[model samples]
Target: MMDVGRHPNIKLLAYSEIESISGYIGNFHVRVRKKARYVDETQCTACGECAKVCPVAVPDEYQLGLSLRKAIYIPFAQAVPSAYLIDMKACLGTNPIACGKCAEKCDKKCINYDMQDEIIEFDAGVVIVATGMDVYDPTELEEYGYTRYENVITSMEFERLISAGGPSDGHFIRPSDKRRPKTVGFIQCVGSRSERRGKPYCSNICCMNTVKDTLLLKDHYPDVEAKVFYIDIRAFGKGFEDLFKRSKEAGVQYIRGIPGEIIEDPVTKNLKVMVEDTTTNRISEHELDMIVLSVGVTPRADMPEVQQLLTLSKTPDGFFMEAHPKLKPVDAPTSGVFFAGCAEAPKDVKDSVTQASAAASRAMTVLSAGKIKLEAITSVINPEICRFCTICAQACPYKAIKVEPKKKSIELIEAMCKGCGTCGAECRFGAIKMRHFTDEQTYAQIDAYLEEDPYNKIIVFACNWCSYAGADTCGGARLQYPPSARLIRTMCSGRVDEDWVLYAFRKGAPIVVVSGCHFVDCHYIDANRWTQKRVEKLWDKLEKLGIRPDRLFLEWISAAEGQRFAKTMIDIERHRQRVTKEEIEYTMKVLSEQK
Candidate 1:
């Protein structure tokens, strides 16, 4: 961090926020709002003269409120630029007449009460999101006694209490009395792996973090007793298992059970925990001087803003979704954006560092190439026929389409397009045509598939990423359902044009199924959502035309689900068998008339 701050080429914009983001890959225009620090960073030295005179004391958030800092202070010990910043909210100089002791005391005269926020604009080729994560606060968990008892603090507070620069000056102590505790209790997964109270995902670092803390305690004070309460210990990382073993060997007791409740003695300020040992099937109470709630990591508070600005997708856990879990773990579905650290998922320190390096390399490669490569599977807008209604623009998941209503113009950014063909499918008029998976090619595939005994065949429009791959997986697994199903592949389910479905039905097909990735897990971001809308519209149209809506089946199938693909095919076959030849002919005639 210090090296980056001093680097000639790197301009470190600390205490700044992204106000707005525009443009696309290799040509991005970004506006940043740099918050006022009230101190000239270039002139002010790291001397503690100004902080010593400031009267107002604020809770140090970096120390998890275990210590107090002056209103004018550096964020942390090794803060980049090594300058003190006045918190406007807490600083008395905000109302200049009240007080300005920091400005008066500064030997360099760098403090300025009239400092205003500055907005800066710049261009960048690629952006990497490494906003990191926030730790879950355990104050709501009354059973843990985090708020009621002073000694029942969080693991972060414990870290501050044990640190050399902490309030206790490297002496571990209870918050109530400021005296070192003989017995300490560590509770793992305080805000994780709980469907009711907290997040259902494992925190990924809590178990190992607790082990390290216990090891630290034993190394400093061997006589101090440390007991860890956890459902299970995950020591899967390199050298992590050895550290867990060392902690156990150092007399740290590991109990395979989550403590149900903590009761603190009002007079002594000691805590009593109730937990059931799953190994022995016994319930017992343990006494401790202090209890540390090992809180889980959660998505940053500003995650929503980041998601909106970057057009990024999020996972079920609320972290930014990667393009692919295995193949492109660090890359965002948005072409030029990448993710690092816990912004993508709850990763450990080493994993975060590794991802950061990979993101840098990816960004360098994109910049070095000077231009982004456009895939062949992008949508092309026919200006002559385009009504410029902006439906295509609205439906585009990547925001690749730009529509000008006044000028009656629509533009497509080829570099930004992910080839989902959502815009083409959403176009009411035949203005936007998807390359590779054109209307003509898709119609031909559907027509040919239903040419011979169409009533017996269930035509399936499967997405290339998920449903189509699922069929291949089914075949590889030797899973048999029925050969009556004929699959037609599109880049995305969103690429399945309504005309293609109408054409299939008019060709005398009994059942037509459209399948793709699940709504939230669309490989092309929200392309599958457009697919759902298109299918619903088709269903309504079919019903209005006196055709059975049930004849059109909509299913979401992932690539790994071979069994599900086979089951879905079997279900379609069963539905097809129920549709009599007379009903098929009637539906075919109705669709033909509608077309």
Candidate 2:
């Protein structure tokens, strides 16, 4: 990152937060709040003379609060800019007027207490999000005894203890008495792969990290006993399995079970871990001087803030969602914004670096072109037909519809619009229209299906990726279903708006079924969840309007579930037969008049 920061083409802007983002992909106007660093980067030489004279000391976050740092100090040894930054929160001038010795001792006089935050605006052709991840806190799992026992420490704290510049100067010692330990226990998956406390996804680095830490211990202390408790050793990467094997060959004991509890010894301040070996079917207890909890990685705490800022969608696990996991892994649903590293999902260091490189290449592909070609399926607003009600603006999920209050007109940004037709469906005045799937195209399909045998037909709106594919799978498998069904495919279930559902009823269709991917496994991230919510609202409205809610159904059918899809359609057809022609006619008349 420091090397990239030194690139002449890339003007590095540090200590900045994005305040606002406007416009669309190719010509985005971004406003950034450049926070004050209070030191001149160009003038200061990163010498340690100023830091030595500073009296104010605070816990160093880079060392995981295991060490102290001067008020005016560098973040770390390899920190970019290689310059001192004043800790305004800890500095005497900002907190209180107790001391100003650091400012007085600086030879270059770079310290400035009066600097204020400045806002700057810039045009970006592309944006890459690589905010990375945070370690899960094990304090909530009280059974681990993390907060109570000084011998129990997280993997991050252990990393610092093994580093040369760490608090104890790379000496592995017990936190209670600073004595060398003969036995250490590594507990794997402390907050991973468990639905009870933390996330369910496998944190990709924990297994390898434990292996690396065990190797580090063996290098420093040859006779020290190291044991690792894991459900299964996941060493899938290149040379990773070799490292795992090497650790075992070097006499590190591998246990096949996570410890249930860690009890502290009263006399020696050691830890006694209780575990049941699944292979041997035996419960065992081990005494260890130090216990390192191999914590899992989770999405950043401010992920929701970033999601709103970029208008990006998130998966059920709260990590940023990719446009397509296999096809467009780095790209976000919003075209220009891309994801890298653990921000997308849990990944190892090698995967992170690979993804970072891929993200850089993807961003360069957009910026190097100097212009972007938008998809043909974007939304369009007709100025002459627009009523200027601003309903489209309110309904658009991507904020693609822009209304000019001064002109009293609405404009659709082609780059930002996803062609979901949600705005067109919500617009009461029929002002907005999607390009490929326009109102006329949709109505034509409905007219074709319902023009003949309208009262007996069952209308099904299936999403392209999942439900539609499921229908194909049913046909390929020769699954038996009713022939009275008519299908219309959309890009996603979210595209099946409320007006469309009501419109099907108005066309004399006895039953209307909206189907898509299952929740959390949506092709468009959480789009299916929105579809679920809309269907529920429609059911409520039907019940309130004295219409039978059973006439409408919402089902989640994955592409692999051919038998289930065939059974669902057959079952719905059986129910549709219960509605007589007179009841269908009466319902259609009432719905049409109401619309």
Candidate 3:
């Protein structure tokens, strides 16, 4: 961090936040708001003179509030710029200029009470998101008595107490009495893998972190008893299993059960924990001098704002979703944007470093190229035929289409397009065309499928990334389904133009199904949202025409759901068999009348 701050080419803007981001991949313009520090970075030195005379003091956030710091202080020991800064919220010099003792004491005269926030702007070719994660607060679980018991602390607080710069000055002590604890209890998964109170996903590092903590405790005091209570220890990483073994050999007890309750002793300030041993089917109670909650990680509280700024997608767990989990883990779905560290998911230091390197390499590749190469398969609009209703623009998840309502014109920016074909499907006037998956080509595929047995055939339009891949997975699994369900692939479910569905229905098709990725998990951000709207519109039209709305089905299918694909196919075929010849003829007559 210090090296990056001093690097000639790198302009490290500390204490700044991005206000807005605009433009495309290679031409991104960003506006930033830099908060005032009340101390000039270039003029101020790393002397602690100002902090010594400051009257105001507050909880140090870097130490998780385990220690107190002066109002005018650096965030941490090795903070970049290595300069003293005032916290306006904690200082008395703000608004009324109540206290100027720090300014008087400062030999360099770097303090400035009149400093204001500065707005800065810059252009970049690529952007990397490395906003780290936050630890889950376990105070919500009242059963653990985390708030009531003074000795019950989180893993982070434990780190601060043990550090040389901590309030304890490198001496491990109980928060209640500042005495070295003879027995300590480490509770794993305090805020992880619990559908009731916490998230469903594993915290990825809690198990190994507990192991390290136990080893560290035993090393400091050989006679001290250390115990870890967990549902199960997942030491799957390299050398992680060995570390767990070492902790056990070093006299750390491993218990396979999460404590159900904790009660503190008023006299001794110790905690009595109750837990059921699943292995022996017996309940046990243990008393310990101190308890440590091995808290899990959570996505940053401001993740939604960051995701919106970059037009990025997020997983159901609230972490930023990668472009592709396997192929493009570091890349965001939006071009020229990449992810690193726990911003993407709950990852350990090793994995975060790996992803950071990958993201940096990807950014380097994008910036090194003088010009970007856009995909040939992008949206094209015919202005003469366009209604300029802005439906295409609204449907585009990437905001690739610009609407000029006054001129009745629509412009498609090919550079920003991912070729999801959402705009093409939403364009009711048939003015927008998806380059490769044009209406003519799609209609031909539909016509070819219905040529043999139109009334018995079940036509399916499957999205290329999800539903089509699901079919391939079904085939690989050798899952058997009725042959009547014929699939036609498109770049996205939004690519399934209503014309293609009407043409199939007019040819006496018994059923037409359109499938894509789940609403939240769309490969092209919210492309599946447009798919839902289009399908709903088609259902409304079919009902008005006196055709059965049930005949047109819209299903959400992902690549991992092979069984769902096969089951859906079988269900569609069964429904096709129940459709009578007269109903098919009626549907065909109604669809044909519309033309």
Candidate 1 local lDDT, 1-595, one digit each (tens) = 9999989989999999999898889888899999999999999997989999899999998887778999999999999989999998898884655788888888899998888999999999899999999999898898887878999988888888899988788998898898889999999998899999889999999999999999999999999999999999999989999999999999999988988889889899999988899999999899999999999999998999999998998888899999998989889999889888999999899999999999999888888988777888899999999998999999888888889999987799999998999888888889998888898898888778877888899899999999999999999999997999999999999988888888888899899999999866799888888888889999998898888899999999999899999999998899899999998889877766666
In candidate 1, list every pair of residues with a backbone clash: none
lDDT score, residue 50, model 3? 92
lDDT of 1 at 108: 92
Off by over 4 Å in 3: 94-97, 406-409
Candidate 2 per-residue C-alpha lDDT over 1-595 given as tens digits, one digit per residue, 9 for 90 to 100:
6887789887777778888887777777899998887887777899878789887899999998888998888998888778888888877764456566767777898878888899999998888898889999999999998979998999999999988888899988878999989999999998999999988988989999999999999988999999999999999989999999999999999999988889998889989988999999898999999999999999999988888888888887878989878888999988788888999999987898898899889988998888887777767788888888887777676788889767887778877877666677666677777777776787889989999988789999998888999999999999988998899988778778788888888889899999998875576545566677789999999887777999999999988888999999999998899988887888788887797
Q: Model 3 over residues 111-189: C-alpha lDDT tens digits? A: 9988999999999999999999989988899999887899999998888888888778889999899999999999999
Summing lDDT over every window of 10 consecutive residues in candidate 2, give the lowest-scoring window.
520-529
Q: Rate the local accuracy (lDDT) of all candidates.
A: 0.91, 0.86, 0.90
Arranged by TM-score, best first: 1, 3, 2
If scored against the real structure, what TM-score would every candidate get? 0.98, 0.95, 0.97
Note the clash tally of each candidate. 0, 0, 0
* Window of ten residues with lowest summed lDDT in model 1: 92-101
Clashing pairs in 2: none
- How does candidate 3 score on lDDT? 0.90
